[model samples]
Target: MRFKYSIPVVFVLALVIIEKENNIISKVSDKLVLKQPPMVLDSSSSLQLLLKPNQSVPSFHFHPRTSAPVFTLMKRRLEDYSSHQPRTQKPKQKHILLLATTRTGSSFVGEFFNQQGDNMFYLFEPLWHVEKMLTLEGGGTNASASAKAYRNVLQQLFLCDFSLLESFIDPPPVDHITSNLFRRWSSSSLCADSVCSPFVQGDFEKFHCKARKCGPLNLTLAAQSCRAKQHRAIKSVRVRQLDMLRPLAEDPRLDVKFIHLVRDPRAVLASRMVAFEKYKNWKEWGTRGGDVPLDDDEVMKLKGNCDNIRMSAQTGLRQPKWLRGRYLLVRYEDIARFPMRKAAEMYRFAGMPFTPQVKSWIARNTQVSPKEASGVYSLQRNSSEHVEKWRFSLPFKIAQVVQRVCRPTLKLFGYKVVNSEKMLTDRSISLIEDKVFNSL
Candidate 1:
């Protein structure tokens, strides 16, 4: 009786082992089945049933002994499904850099690009903060390092990265009467279409912004708007050297193009003097503090700036054919005299179509009368009238000084020198009133 009982126990143990081996084989078959078509789901079908689009896991009957393996296979199939899904491709954006100096009508040119449409994004003086940072870090005097830093900042900006511009986004307190108007103006102009739009339009119900304060929301919107554009442009007066931007111009990823905006140095000088005087009067009234007083040093600095502008233009025009193809020299005078014609050419150079909307914008902005409130500094002005104002505004002595200093620059840009003494005694001088001269 003891021997018979032991034999039954041995037979039972052998059957259990065989069952375990079958379960292992079933799991292997399930995995192999994944490789076959989903239609092949007969009894011989391997693990691939999990991949069928409409099939439910609960609909399939698994052997009770192999339930754990079925659950494991289901989990893996879900993961594989997720991993095999398609991904979206990012849209390619064009990058444009406008090379110019201060008071060269760069603002107008920048705005032209910005106003092209909702699809175009423009940045104004993005390098201002970089210059400030360099000064604070004692790298301002290091030309090579400063240029490299500027290029890096520009690269990040072209890629729609605004993380680096956070500190510079702070607007002045509106209550601070001594804040520089020009600084406020620059910040306001730069953020107008983007960060400050809702606030500026008094759309409090839509967006809330504290008086003269810009928060993260502003930066985010600006970055998003920039990233959404098919074309991106940045205008800077700090980058006076074309060579400083050679690497960016040649960058394969950027599809970069350069617009070298040249202005008559004499006109530039005259404008600077007039602006300096106005700034001085503003400072004297204590409406602003930390203003740079016009002194011999300031004069020398202005002269140096003019020289650099001239040199950059001259150098760019003289570049070799391969490099020259990437650059387009646009004269402030020509743009002022014939905005629509030049604008079309500029758009073509930028590889964009000159649409009707752009034409309408050009007409609206460039057709203002000479007596308009913002005729002096506003982007909206009678282009011809505004361009010729310098001729009447600069005094004979000042004109002579500017002419002598900027002779080569003026010649390079094809600007004819006016006879200062003759002009001073002419009827043109009679047209400008004492009030206009004082205003200048």
Candidate 2:
């Protein structure tokens, strides 16, 4: 008897796509609830990295020919490695780093790669470790020295290349889509462990951050061992602290990939305002003190927070043009345009291998349309209506205020405010008051 293989056998071996539209049970104003794919991997392969309301697990399937390994198998292997377990002796060279502001789709992008198995480690907020020395034992009694240690720890953690240190710093970058300021810091000479700036002296340390005991020597060994540790790494951190990343990126060992994910200001503003309004006032809504009602000062502080992040995001996109070859600007509109294409490009940019199954997995799980079809087999285009829904969703007065504040930045991203004349003419609404119109 001869062994025979057939297409039906291949199809049977393939994992079917899951449709998620009907499953989208909730829709928050500006934020759309993505339908979860029914075809989830086993719990062992699933990662708990995602924040709630957007909790997702990366899924994979195997190729039919050559009995290629199942996507899920790769996912499991990676999970083991990230958690610090050994899978294979061979080291992989492709490492990727993603840099972006909050709410700019960095989380989702990181998640996409993470689902691919032991290839990429999704490191969120790599700077937090260094910044935490102020609270840790033996960090330092003096604020200045403490700050230096904090910065040093962060540098070594990210650049030193230890799997254990991955817990402390973001993995190296094969690609980085970071803000201009962050790119500046990550590329700075002063960020090194040895170069303790004056800021790390006297009172400066109290205000700034530095790394701890993990200096250049220990970091070097870690870096050598973990150099080819993960297939790739993605870093999505706040823009305010980008200045710290300067030194580590200088090393020839670090390969940084840049991807800028931007959303239309109107939508971003709408989404943010709604989130704040709902969460900030939760206590008043009787959620058992879950939400805190903020006074004018608090509201102002929140507004500033929003403005800072938005400004950082805007600056990140603009700054890369000066270094065009190293960066790629991707709009939320475009990513939403054909998420699969954008995802594939991102994978290629990160130097990771994109399996056919991964492509299928994205199509099925990332469906975001009115239609109910969602699964590895189905694909949908980005909803244009969602792109500028803020025009209608946000109140006119608030929209005006947002426009006043965000207009200049919006222009930087290639968008112009709709002037009153254009709004009146376009909507065909008379500007004159009703009484004046009647008298006329």
Candidate 3:
């Protein structure tokens, strides 16, 4: 009986020993696995892994001993994932807002961008209607509200949305007769391009019947086409301050850039005086006299305009970093003097290639004698001759007042103040005369 019991105990002890040996072997195998470098999946291996059976999957993780290669694999996988992912589309359209005051050659600048052929759609003072709308809404005196509305309107206009403009269609801004004319012309052009003869006939019922199907009648086709173009630009002298457009300038959805077109105050005053004289009988004339000395009201108006110019210059110069590459300060005098060079610079700033077609347009529009260029509101001009014409034409008293009111801005823009005789004799050019001088 003792022998049998001892034999059973011996068998139990043997079983325990075998189990201990198996545990030791398993631990050694694990150590060996840790000693080897982690396996990383290359493109082919990764693809194979993707194809493999779900239950027989290799581990994506590595042994703790090879943490470095594990991280490398992680980085590689991330790169691969990014490379294989679908790319997001970027905004195709770009907007250019020409920030300028009245009589600062903004119209010429507008025409320059407009004549960029089919790829460019140019709007002349789209904000005039906004101002009128603001007045109608009784928010004219509230600068902040007016600015917000103006920016909102600009956003819609840039996106080629004209539904908001229907409200202002019936009785548009009285001061914007030119804006009305442009609307009529655009409507006529769109109708000509897309509408049938029956739609255009005097019979209102037939026109209305066809108009429902012809969507171009509701919105500007030029503007709609512009949405797909390389560039869309708008020029406005109504905007008195650059700060008012800070939101638009910094918007990422719309690639917006600003061209601050400035003119010498003395020259601007002289032009206004000349216009005042030419259109004295016109009720819409902002200035009262031309040959006669400036009345108190006229002087005050000139002073206010000069102050606005100064403010705009200061605002542009102090732009933040985001606006650094977007804001371009251009002088009317410089553009007038060197049309081709300045235009090329402008195109570069606007991210457009300067084609031979653009060069041809500049040459055709700008090749005119000073005598022939006079009394015409056109892009063609004897630019060099036009630059200093204000010096000879402006009266001495008027010059002094403009010089005094615009002294700070004159200095900022590199314009010099001189006596009447010196103004005629001195060949002092624009202070900021360099083609590539973008202080902003």
Candidate 4:
């Protein structure tokens, strides 16, 4: 009976204290809702301090000196302020790798992403620096070591980190600074005012940006520009194997996409003969119009180049778990025939917007004068016409040799083999079979 009496006393005390708090609150204004706090039982004693809810809705009792209406308004404001939505974070940056062999229309395809304006950060042949430096150090000639080095540099570049690249820069960048980035003018991102200001009034003429026209490339500024971009893309003809990029693809920080570009072996051989001064021997070989030795260095080189491209294509087409929804194979012939359509497809694969600027650039560059398309390394061309132009220039004997050595590559990429010299040089007949290498 005494314990029950003590319980009532405790409840009364709790109620009195709550009532006093309410009185102070009432003096301010009458509109504020009075919410009862939870009733709690004391473990040490038989005392129960209880608070009964006035209604289901949340009610607050503010202090004295504030009117009920003022308190209510303040309470509403507090509630409204406290219930604000969480901030939305930006999506992970898209890291794109454009992989191809030399003279495969990679420059033209790379420009598709490079011309995406400020939102994109594109680098052209950044691996060239690595290969150059490593070769000087005698490590580049070793294929495995060189591929690993290229991968490391590429990984850093995609992260917008230039620290590793600085190590490979010619004359070596002092304190993360360098002016001699390989093909510096090739990447619009590097040429932008953000990275390097133009020394000359017209830094960019037609499609080419002359390096002399621009100031030294500040790596710090380049990095800042890279991070500011929503996407990053690097074009490389150096790294040979598609499987070599597994680590980069599986990286948690990057959303990576690999775009592999391939051209017909006959076309590649023909173009290499014209473009590279080093291919003079090949030119001599073709002009001789004799049987090409299968064991000869030049013939072996042709076989190796074609075989590597074929193998890489095969690997990408397999679409292993690490590379799923990330690998795309594009035939240079298909891109040449359909520039806008193929470019849009590539941009779509990389999850980038295909803007009108790129569209306009494609239109202007792809249908230039013969003079504009003359450079050995020129991206400007009459694309559709150039696809079959190889047939006219490439000797039938040389074409046969390419067919013999690169038969697997030809069949895989949908290039038809010719029976005789007449068939090899005939532009009237189509050699490219209808094929789709790039699909969602």
Candidate 5:
């Protein structure tokens, strides 16, 4: 008797051998859900089986030759995927850092990246924890010390290493788990099911979060989530200067892009007064109806913020060797008026695909009534209407003081100077100049 091998027999043997030799899922028998193919299939050429929803896994079939009638099933080898192939250079990952101060529309702009869907892991003020923990631990808040610590924490976080972050959390998390991630709810990637669970209550108080049951997300789990993401973005208002971030930006292991966001200095002071209780004194001073000297501690504090903002932008605009093709300057006023257009630019600058989801979010967020997004930190707003609210809120005298103190910054960024009280309050007159600030 002669031994003859049929195509089915050879195919079964091949599938078994592939399964034994490789780590990839053997598509024929694994319970993987089959997705519908784009076209009808045939055996003469390799083709995907058209599948319906809930369809069972199907065999992959092909004919070895045009003259033969034999049909065969085959499993894709582990090496078949482009990702598994040996490469001379690894693909660069997008790591974006949005540098801005409080009241510069940082939160609003951050949503552009955060809503890029599941492939993005967003960090909303991870430095908030570092700042709080350092303050409690007696770590001085001097510029050098603070910037150094911030730089270190950011570097590790981008790498998905949570240990450095865990060390900074007060009332340390147990077994690399914690519920106190600052606004942990803000990052959907962190709140995903694989990394977090419903908060439980006890002496330790099982992570009870009101907005979502998610709490006590494991640092290990968070790291896993971050690693799974193709890109990471950090939005922070605490970084006083762009130069402080040079080490992280220049690291050979990472590709980092910076979006330097700025707003008018006078508007910043006006918004800060309403949003921060610590500014009550400044509020009182504004309401006291007198000339505020440029040298007042409060005024100087505002001036310092302006100085940092201007300097950082000027540095980025210069496009230093380190920052070339990695820096962008964005004004809140421009974004407020054309939310979707500016969002596309920022996404392009970061070298990330601009997704339809972000476009939809911008459309909904920018056109809504202010009441729906009126909270001090709410991301939603009628953007065009909201930017000018500060104009009416800041008294003329206070505005004049800001103009004098933040003059250099204001002029550098092309804000129209209001020469009189009437010019300051007239909403009919546009205060923002139609000048473009380029980072290239």
Candidate 6:
């Protein structure tokens, strides 16, 4: 069997090389500069842009090496604030939000963005309330315990200093002294309304407030916050909640942007199945809905749920036109296959300053080459060819049942359905007979 890295191996090597070149001499002591410069028009770049529901562009250009701002700027608060200050020095802050789904490579993207020196503070999914839930789950703490815990977590995270994070990853200070009282006070005074406190001020404040004094994040008015590194990016999957976003959008201080990512249901499902089989051995004892092997019924239902989520997201995006262009959908297939080009596109969309480093990074990390195997569901790649294994991985009748259950919603996201007549055809029968014969 020709086993290789699940994603492109070449891209991984490029990343390692780039890491070494960037003075990432030690893994533990240094935080990798994860973020790339924003996208600009590069004539040498390739890969086609897949349009979102409301984005309109005549022609998109990918530059080989040019200083182009990657994303559309809704507004630049710090730059404006600096204009009001004494001309002795300039002040600037950039706030970026990466609105993504689970398993959409957000952490990788955030890591790239975090490398912008002290200019950008990349916040991982540090929602403390959620983190503290393991303990909370043990008892009936309060009637609104979950909500209160979530709120408290948000408050703490928003107030925590992000600069300390870089140090945490590569600690110079054994126990970096931070004043939690100061943070709590800062959290209260900075934004009064608990609901609008983090950004206006809400959950994220649980993380962002402390950076004000403990680290470089100075707690000044939005107009005067000149720690150029004042700019921050939140990479969290939970931000998909529209209710959560609506409040943050209302905050006058924040220049919020959303980057939404998507993937083909077929590809996602295939990858997920492979992951499940490898990790859980779901096949050996059967799956959740059945004590016996999964029937077609279960597989079909899985497909339907996946498709429905994507379609609902698509539909939901249309109603909120304010999120147009700002809320971009990235296909996982494109990211895996043409990472450099895709990275360039994302840089451009985010309005960050793109540099040669980005080009070098893309050349190294983007998966621009063809894939040798589409994955486990293939013949030539491996003898364990479950390629379309969905056909035989489950009981034939159950598989059919799953297909029927999920059929209505499956095609919307690009899944093809095999009719009942075709299931009993010569090819299908032969494949099944072979599987059953092999088993005996």
Residues 1-440 of candidate 4: C-alpha lDDT, one tens digit per residue = 54434434433444455444644423322222342223321122111112233312122333356644333454354444434635468866899999988888888889988888888999999888778866745332678988899889899999999999998877787666566777778888887877765455533333234644565567888999999988999999998888888999998988999999988988887888988888887788778856767798778878888888888888888777888999998888999999999999988888877899999999999998889898888889999888888888888888888999999999999999999878877778899999876532
Cα TM-score per model:
0.62, 0.46, 0.67, 0.77, 0.77, 0.44
Where in model 4 is the C-alpha error above 4 Å?
1-89, 136-140, 197-213, 438-440
Candidate 6 ranges with C-alpha deviation above 4 Å: 1-92, 115-118, 128-230, 269-281, 285-308, 319-325, 367-440
lDDT of 5 by residue, 1-440 (tens): 11133334444444445545443334432322243232322232112232223433234333456432222123333224423645577556899999899888898899898899988999889998777865634443667777888999999989999898888887788999776778777777776777766556552433333455665778898888899899999999888888888998789888999988899988888888999998887888788966676677778888888898889999999989988898899999999998888899998888889999899989988988867988988889998898778888898888888888899999888899998888988989999998887652
lDDT, each prediction: 0.62, 0.43, 0.61, 0.77, 0.77, 0.41
Model 6 misses residue 295 by how many Å? 12
**Model 2: residue 197 alpha-carbon error in angstroms:** 41
Model 5 steric clash pairs: 200-206
**Candidate 5 wrongly placed segments (more than 4 Å):** 1-91, 136-140, 201-211
Worst 10 residues of 4 by lDDT: 40-49
User: For model 6, what is the error of residue 175's alpha carbon versus the real structure, in angstroms, after optimal superposition?
Assistant: 8.3
Summarize candidate 6's per-residue lDDT along 125-222 as a digit string, tens digits: 64422433423455423324443433343333333343323232221222432222122322222222221222332223223453342222232322
Off by over 4 Å in 1: 1-92, 136-142, 167-218, 277-296, 373-376, 424-440
Give RMSD to native, each candidate.
Answer: 17.2, 24.8, 13.7, 11.1, 12.1, 24.1
lDDT of 1: 0.62
